[model samples]
Target: MDALPFALLLCGVFLFAGAVKGLLGLGLPTVAMGLLGLAMPPVQAAALLLVPSLVTNVWQLLAGPRFGALLARLWPMMLGIVAGTLTGSGIIAGAAARNASVALGIALALYGLVGLLKPQLRVPPSVEPWAGPLVGAVTGLVTGATGVFVIPAVPYLGSLDLDRNDLVQALGLSFTVSTLALAVGLALHGALPLAASGASLLAVLPALLGMWFGGWLRLRVRPETFRRGFFVGLLLLGGDLARRGLA
Candidate 1:
C-alpha cells in the first residue's frame, strides 16, 4: 500500500477502535488488531497499536474514581503480566504470519464466544490472590504471542462482579498494564521499528477523536445492544481470519 493510503487506513482503524473503547470502556486493541491483521503482519499490527492503546487506556484508568484501590488489588497480576510478556516475546517475534493469524483468530473467536454467552463464572474473594496473577500471566503470554490481549483476563475480571463503574475502571487498569507490557515485549523482540512507532504516534489523534465521538454516542445508545453487535462482529471476523490462516 502507498504511504498515504496506509496512513489513512491506520486512521480509520484506530478511529473505529477508539470509538468502541469510548462507548464500551474497552475493545480498542481487540478491534484494532482484528482489523489490522487483515492488512498486515500481526507483529506489525501490534507495533502500531502500542501508542494509542497506552494513551487511551491510561486516560480510561485515571477517569475512574477507584484507581488506588484497583491498583492495590491488582498489582500482583500486573507484575505477572510484565514477566509473562517478556518471557513470551520471542513467540510472536519468531512466529510465521499464518501461525500468528491463527492465534489471533482463536483469541478473538473465544473472546466473542464468551461475550455472547455471558457465562457466570465467579472468582471467590479468597481465591483471587492466587488466581489474579495466574490469569494475568496467561493473558500476557497470549498477548505476546498473538498481539491480542483479551481472554482469560477479561473473563476473570467479569467474575469479580464489581459494580459498573468499578468494573470499567478495573478494565482500564488491566488494559493499561497489558498495553505497556506488550510495548516492552515488542521492543525487546525488535519488532517495534521506528517507522511503526511514528505511525502509531500519528494515529493517536484519530483514535482520540473517535473516542470523543463514541463517548457522545454512549449517552444516546443502549450499551447492551451495542455490546451484542460487537461480539457478533468479532465472531464473524475471527472465523474468517482463522479460515484464511489455515488456507
Candidate 2:
C-alpha cells in the first residue's frame, strides 16, 4: 500500500526489464530490481520484482524444448540456488542487505555486459550439472542479500560454448525456479506481505509485455549482435550501481 505510487513507477521499469530479458533471455530482475532498489527499500523492490519474474519466465520456459533439457542438465544449480536462498534469506538483513543491494546493482550492470559480449564462451554441456549447484549457491547468496544474482551466473554460463539461446534458456529456467522459491520463502517468513505481493503482480504486466517484444526482436538479431548489445547494457548497469553506491 505504501509503495503504491512507487509500485506504479515500476510499471515503466518492468517495460525496460521485459524488453531486455526478452532480447537477452535474462536481466529482468537485474534491470527492474536494480533500478527500483536505488529508489526504494531493497526488500520492497525485490518483493515487487517477484511476480514479474515468474510471469515473464513462464513464457520463456515455454519458448521450446530447450527448457526441458535445461532443467535436467542444470539440476545442481537449482539446488544451490534453493539452498542459498534459504540461507541468505534467513541470515542477512537491514543495512547489510542494503549494502549488498548497492553492490549487486553494480554487479548486475557489469554482469549483464560481460554475458552479452561473450555469449558463446562455452564449456561442455556436462559442466552444467555441477554448474547448476555452484552458481545457484553464489546467486542465491547474492540474490538473497540484494535480491539479484543471475547477472554473474549468466556470464558464467555464457563462458560455455553451447548455443547462446540455449544457454539463456537454461539460466532462465533455473532462475525461474530459484526466484519463485525465494519469494515463497520470504513471504512465508512474513518478510513480504500482501501489499508487496499484489504490487509485485502489477509490476509483471509491463515486464511480460516487454518480454513479448524481446522475443520478437530476438528473431532479428544476429547472435553476436545480441551478445554485444546485451553486454553494453551490462556496463551501463554496472556504472549505475557504482554511482548509487558512491552517492
Taking the tens digit of each residue's C-alpha lDDT, what string does model 1 give over 1-247?
A: 8999998899999999999988988899999999999998889999999899999988888887989998898888888788888777777777577888898898999999999999999899999899999999998898888877788888998899898888888888888888888888888878889999999999899999989999999999998999999999999999988898999
C-alpha lDDT values of all predictions: 0.89, 0.72
**Candidate 1, which segments miss by more than 4 Å at Cα?**
none
Residue clash pairs of candidate 1: none
Top candidate, metric TM-score: 1
- Using all chains and alpha carbons, the TM-scores for the candidates as numbered come to 0.97, 0.82
- Candidate 1 yields a Cα-based lDDT of 0.89
**lDDT tens readout by residue for model 2, 1-247:** 3557775677888998888887767778877776786677677777888888887776666766677666766677778877887777653344455465566666666676666545555556666677757777887877777677574566676665658678657766766876786786677557888988887877777887888888788888765676676667667766776676667
